[model samples]
Target: MKLFRSKQANSLTELVKACQKQDHQAQVQLYERYKGRLMGICLRYARTEAEAEDIFQEGILKIFDRIGDLKKPESVDSWVKTVMIRYAIDYYNQVTKGQKQLISTDYIETEWESDDYQNLFSKLHTEVLLETINELPEGYRMVINLYFVDGYSHAEIAQLLGISEGTSRSQLLRGRNLLIKKLDLKGVKQHEKF
Candidate 1:
């Protein structure tokens, strides 16, 4: 396993070097290797399949354009993911610019008991959870995706979305509450205290 891992990393390094030299075949190979994972990132950030495609394409172009700037070839996957996320945010901002706000100032508070929904969430399918998340209001969805799925800090989300850390926290809280309600409507039972 260690040998295979080293070989994989070495191959990736070679690929990055070739891509930096503008080798078309290496670029295609790199794209093919990363496209699926990057597409998943794009899909999470985009409301529609078409929009996701647009984001993915833009992200790929950015990656190609900036491949020479990559300092650590071993971290290429993470760098690619970061690029896709930035492109997704940019695309979202462009699409929603000058639009009515989707985030509500009115906050909902719920007392979450320990291990209250663990079993319920454990029993649910990933697809179901993803669908429920996608149904969230745009701001809620973005916050949830950035915070929960992508493991971005609230401070990072605030910077990404041009909001305060308090707003990011509020949005995350509200998004979770909305998710719980949706899960309840789907017949996932919670503890009586919930």
Candidate 2:
């Protein structure tokens, strides 16, 4: 039982130790605990649920393969997040095939400070939102997801998508307009209380 308890200094020591010893049950426990959050993270970058699931699985495999290289156990969450983000960027690169230019994110600020962000998301089913996003044209969908879903700035999105900052901004504007039209929310002011 003590072996199952991670060292106090190392947040991920228990999971890491279990994985190292090929403890399937421990691995399953870890997966169950983190699956939802990681999926949410992956969903922002993936164009579809199928793709997001694939990314999630790949990210877990990456964790398994690279956990041994982690010098600090407590940093497990951050480490996993880094791997996931990198995987998404790589996937985007592979899928887009050099269509986007990497842009910067120094000036993009989000206005979603109200609790409404959570409430709005709760009211809007994930599947519906995803379907709507999937319906967007390739470039618009990617920019919108990266900016709003993944919390990347226009600059970061431009860089990630290999487009100019202006292009990223334009795509985001276009994506939002398309979404409003699709969802029938045209003429509504930005930040209007739902």
Candidate 3:
């Protein structure tokens, strides 16, 4: 088992090819290789680790199911990431379906990076920051994850989540404020920045 575990780290191209052919061992290896990355992506969008696990499990299955269609084995990393993100978006859409709050307003741009906050950020840890972000309201969290974490523009997020650009901007602003408040409340206690 130890040797197999070590072996899984080598030969990603071969791993992907074997996975494409539905080899069960290779499939397991592929999962082992990408599980942390897949789960990290899910965690950014999810409210809790459990929810992230649910998304991670679903995304992994989806990734394998479509692996056979992969054109470039070397590109599997990005391919899997794209699929996981899309699936997370689907999960968000389905969960937020009837409860969607469309707040239409001109973009409210507030600078979160004040000099005071910059000092705090310099001492903050990644886990603490992620926890703070996760504490945001569902809509706010989703928009924050999409826009900042996932690097999607407001227009792109609006299109992806079927919300208006104004709404996306609104959510992101609200999310940022909430995150700042949370961070302010929880000052750095022997914490070091990531």
Query: Highest lDDT, which number?
Result: 1
**Candidate 1 lDDT score relative to the true structure:** 0.81
lDDT of 3 at 96: 50
State the local distance difference test value for candidate 2: 0.67
Q: State model 3's lDDT.
A: 0.78
> What TM-score does prediction 2 earn?
0.62
In candidate 3, what are the lDDT values of residues 1-194, reduced to their tens digit? 11123333347788888998899999987898778877888888887898899999998899999999999787777788878988998988887555755443423554665587887676667887888777777778888887877778999899888889998987788777767667766655534222
Ordered by TM-score, highest first, the candidates read: 1, 3, 2
The CA lDDT at 126 in model 2 is: 55
lDDT of 2 by residue, 1-194 (tens): 12123345353677767766778887787677667777776876677788888888888888778767877666666666667777766776787545653332322333445763445444555566766676676677778877776567887877776789998888787677666455433113222544
TM-score (C-alpha) between model 1 and the true structure = 0.86
Q: For each candidate, give its TM-score against the true structure.
A: 0.86, 0.62, 0.80
lDDT of candidate 1 over 46-112, digit per residue (tens): 8778888989998899999999999988778778888889989988878964576566543568777
The candidates, ranked best first by lDDT, are 1, 3, 2
Query: What 10-residue stretch in candidate 3 is worst by lDDT?
Result: 1-10
